[model samples]
Target: MTNPDKTGLKPTCREAHRLVSEGMDRELSFVERTRLRLHLMVCDGCTRFNGQMALLRTAMRRFPDEHGK
Candidate 1:
């Protein structure tokens, strides 16, 4: 869906960016998650970015301390 109409609606790319990071850390409200999903549907960059973030997170979890001390 396009940007929100008149009274503060869908998340913008900037907000979606924050949402992407937020989603990784904590549970988002249904409204927040829905807005992010809708944004990702239309924004290719964000979609890919989100995927990459998820992948990075997964890899980190799979291989802890990639940079050994």
Candidate 2:
């Protein structure tokens, strides 16, 4: 998971997971995006996890509130 600039080594799964979450909240640095992409390319679990997070995020965003209280 070398960065676009080839700065550092690949990130671990934990780090990749964090990066995925961070990516949703804010723009990721090139290094972070690269590492996460590389990790997701190989890690099926994390890939699925990322998709699930996206699905859940969308669901929450679209959920309607009925109560005014």
For candidate 1, write residues 1-69 as lDDT tens digits. Answer: 634532355567888889999989999998888888888888999999899999989997888575773
Models 1 onward score TM values of: 0.78, 0.73
Candidate 2 deviant stretches above 4 angstroms: 1-8, 65-69
Model 1 residue runs over 4 Å out of place are 1-7, 65-69
Best by TM-score: 1
Instruction: Compute the lDDT of residue 15 as modeled in candidate 1.
Output: 87
The clash numbers for all candidates, in the given order, read 0, 0
Local error of candidate 1 at residue 54 (angstroms): 0.5
Candidate 2 versus truth, CA RMSD in Å, comes to 4.9
